[model samples]
Target: MQFLFADCVLDEERRELTRASQAVSVGPQVFDLLLYLVQNRDRVVSKDHMIESVWGGRIVSESTLTSHINAVRKAIGDSGEEQLLVRTVPRKGFRFVADVSEAQNPERLSTDASILSLEATKPSIAVLPFQNLSGDPDQAYFADGVVEEIITALSRVRWLFVIARNSSFTYRDRDVDLKQVGRELGVGYVLEGSLRKVGDLVRITGQLIDASTGTHLWAERFEGQLENIFALQDEISASVVGAIAPQVELAEIERAKRNPTRCATAYDCYLRGLAQMHRGDEEAIGEAITFFKRTIEIDVESASAHAMAAWCYFWRKVNGWSTDLDKDESEGLRMAQRAVELGRDDAVALTRGGHALAHFTRDLDTGIALLDRAIFLNPNLASAWFLGGFLRTWHGECESAIEHFERAMRLSPVDPELYRMQGGIAMAHLFAGRIEEASVWAERSYRNLPSFLMVVALLASTRALSGRQEDARRAIEDVQRLNPSLRVSNIADWLPISRPEHIAVFADGLRKAGLAE
Candidate 1:
């Protein structure tokens, strides 16, 4: 008989256990203990019964039995804390509480909804159940939790559409075809992973695949101590998202950090604010400002809070959402300076605060230096590269600007701000006098973010410079539609340009496209 629960299968006839199609290794005593439990899952098995049946009636000490049981738990991915499959009935014997499916034949089976085929508009992904390789069947809970956390993290990204857990879990019972899963789930990508727990350590393996062509995009393995399992989960989730995004890399900056104040609620509030900040909209920025301020009220020494709040103000300035430029910029500069001072060693805090400083003060040299330090601190930070690239373009380093923008794009191709990266590329081309290429790239950027005034302006300028008069005129209409008060005379103030020639080149397009002088 073959018994299956979660992603693990135990074959009694073969005296074997496999997870995710991989053979698991367990000691003979632990194997017998697990098998006896599954075979008699309907009833509890006492210590005396286990000793007699599995140990050939040999004399077994309480410590010996406890050690073997613990081994069984370790081998299956279960712990004393999380007893999902194995349950201790007070002073009585142990019982298997999980719902078990038994099959006489060895063939795999799946009852969960199988994917047929559907068209997905944006980058869509499904995180299937991770196979538990802890020879012990109880480890299913650990594997399941890991998948859930990954799904949650990915779903937080506004752009990528994530398949619901129920839909993705349908394939948990059996092997699946990538193409069918893609079609049935209406997704472009599938993320498959496995978990293995051995002694004090655990190893996780994840692979991202293009469902349509069965092409393997990326695969990674992570190993860490069980004590830091939560931290390891964050690392894996961030890495998995980074891989799928094609260089859209971000470090697991949170790293299971509990608030120094020992307040979970306060920490949660801070995190909620971070989610809103990443949305990058005027309304969302305002929402984040409120959240971050509350976090400061709860914990006075929150460097991250100060940094993010500083960024909210800077973003407002760049987008022309600020009502009072003087007051906002002053406060923004102070918050940004505080974040930088406090987060001397924190890459996330430094990156955010440094970007805000660069924009608020227009100090290109200082901004670029701080961002460079941020990258040195955490090489996977894509935001730093993208921000620095834009700064470089304004500083008249077009080649370097193009390189940085491309680097950011490669890291996070499916990033929600993908249009911004494309727009930066257009700006670089515009500065370098590659008018036709600039026009093409700008048009693509505008399509992705039609309401973005910067992109609209870019398209207009590039088109006019490239002799695409009609296209340029349409771009002007779009930009003016968003902000009719914008005029060529003041357009230079909106652009973060330092070099006179670069500003002139950009303004020429807007002027030619019929903006008011």
Candidate 2:
């Protein structure tokens, strides 16, 4: 389908958005949203309607919807106030108001078909839930965690569009044809795998297939001692990504490599903990903590596990699920420090450890150095880039922070925790004295995750600073409702920024946003 607006044309089948005969950069989701809006130009689409139509009714917050809206506007040189191309009718919803005309592009369709016929045209891939070949059903979590990691690792490549785990796992244990699966899911490639663990040895087998003709693109068997499972997974993922997207840079391929674990069981426990962490509830966090602790108990030298456990505690404190902030903060800082001391060669451990140190301990210089080293080791480490961005923003390096945040977004385009990156961007904009841009990013951050206290607070303050009094008040009310115990006295202490000016800006924004003492 071809959509023409102004001088730009979006060809959905070709997966290309062009302006003045030149291709422009538009992320996958933004492209999808644009295609939907232009295709249904005559309608007033509500948020629910758009979510159902665009996101296939997946569970996403209002913040996600707003981010897409902002993306679309940014693409078209439009804004909330201008509403030149897309108009928002308040509570009712949105409409595409531009003079758009459908264009017939036989050449574009032919080009798309030609590209589709190519061996690499298999644009879609699904990472099926790995079979728990282990005897104990309790190990199901381990197998599931492996599949989840593969999904996450693969999703980091911007060139590949991965089906979310929730959607892909629907085929679990179902006998289905690859061709039919491809047609149903609208993907050209499918990946299926199995995991078996016995004693201290593990075996993993995976195959990548062209869904069109059921032709194997690549297949490999990974066998290693249980202690090296993490390394084995990384090797398989890096190999697969390299095979599918040959254009991916060498630096990124190395970044895709997973750090080796000191013990296999510790890796297993860490994976289990990760699976539980996704639930984002107090009970889940507790379970995750237990798993992490078990991993550490099994292998105290497992730096990655220790750092991840510290991260869990950090979140528990932030979410108000833990009453003992002092204990949580102290333990998190200790584990992070120990992780760094033990795993100097491990980028993942270093990133998490640095983040904990920077946020919990307020050690800016040491934390920034650690994070920078982590990024240098693995440029594809999205979390490292994210933490680096936050640290840089607080250190008054707004441009550098934006660069890091943009890199993070590119690496993890569909990250479930995208609000964190957006919040970083908002903070950078605010610190750079771009009030309007700050307001935009702050709104986008809040739109992607309403329950994100940091984003809510940032948005409230940005709005107030921008002179949007009512909007600021609304944001403040939302934050107060979300955290009834919130008070001005404790905010500065809780905030991760180290610089006085950064703290002052945040506190001032909150004060102006009408936060009660």
Candidate 3:
């Protein structure tokens, strides 16, 4: 495979790079780095991804990495400052920003084996960080906050493929090309705007561009008071997406907007909590809980805050991150119950709190109902679909669970919760008694998140049941390394499988893998 951009050609088969038909001198590391970036050009590549792919997870110094990046830039007739082709996303690593066209065998192009294609299947748009035109610099946060609100609002539209913020924000503080930005993020439309705040008034100017032809689809300027920021965000998002896909049902966007808080400060706190929560580690989740609690203190009726807080505790209980399991479970149930009681109309709150209540309290019926209502209320809510799928797996409805899981995947193809979704697919297959299919899904999930003990257990069970004794034993060792104590009689204490047959299948597999009964 070869990539052509600007006056350069990068040939992967020959392991060569050229600028203006002249061979460029580059080390093996630099060549590998460039190839990785080009193949993953559809999204921002993280530093961890670079290390894992280029260095084989070996320890490499920061300065050395930066130096290699510079070398790659130079060879491609680009510079770190200009970033014409290679752009560094602060703290997020780098992206190949140039427009690249593939020149390769069609079969090889389709089966790169290294990259997951982000082809747009739905009407998609990326709202890049709104420029802070206020010149105060202090209003940078406000501008970014508005952009995030717009992104969140757009994400709720099921027919829209909204690029995640991290990928869009990679081009921040740089001279942007709308066509190039669209190509890099795999979106059809791009929204670039500026925000200016003065005293108690604010003005937002936005222009929507068709990246395919660099055509201006829509342009608008919104003027409103500081307190009316949320309303402006909703209007801007609705107008932008409405222009792109006129078929986008406005009712779904309205469903998502119903939970917006009256107090911006409380909303800010909730956003901060969310930022911390997405980190997916124990310590970050704890801090996220603190911020969420603060949001609730400011507005006791904040259903989203209550729901997020419940989810934090629920995560702690499930991931074995808490020292006092009983105490945490009790607290989590209380918060989740309150959230469900107050958030009957809010999809976000219902989805999060509903899953927490159902998963932790074993109230499968009510939990699944809440998730069902959430999906009906907002079909675009990917998490709701995924969580609902998991609950269905527990209810022994494998086919229905698989449908919802596929819907979730179609909505958010590159979802950060991909591991959780894959786990749901594994369980769905397990419930259907397809041991081989179950093993394939479980192994994929475990590879994405090795720390997930449940996926490791599934990998062991499926392999053992498929008569792959040696591979099963290796997976069993992983499960034991994650948790030493294991016995068939006590298996229910760890896994949530309720059906006797399903439990027996796992137990028998584990026993076959040399675990004691």
Clash counts for all predictions: 13, 4, 0
Encode model 2's per-residue lDDT on 1-517: one tens digit a residue: 6788887888877777777776555545677788888888899888888888866777666765887798788777789889999999889999998998776666533433443432222245777887778787876666676678778766755335688999989998788888777766666678887878888777777787667678776666666675765676665555444344432222122222232542234444566676666555578788888888887665445677788877778777766666787888888888887778655667778887887778787777888999988866655677788889988987788999999998777655655556888988998988888878888887887777676677788888888888889999999998898777777667866666656777777778889988987
TM-score of 1: 0.53
Task: List where candidate 3 sits over 4 angstroms from the true fold.
Answer: 1-264
- Residues 76-135, model 3: lDDT tens digits: 889978999999888887999899999883343322221112221135678899898887
Ranking by TM-score: 1, 3, 2
Q: Could you tell me how far off, in angstroms, the CA of residue 394 lies in candidate 2 after the best superposition?
A: 1.9
* TM-scores for candidates 1 onward, in order: 0.53, 0.51, 0.51
- The residue pairs that clash in candidate 2, if any, are 63-447, 63-448, 64-448, 227-264
Please give the ranking of all candidate structures by lDDT, highest first, separated by commas. Answer: 3, 1, 2
Preferred candidate (lDDT higher): 1 or 2: 1
lDDT of 1 by residue, 160-224 (tens): 56899999999996888987888777776788988888898888898887776787777778777
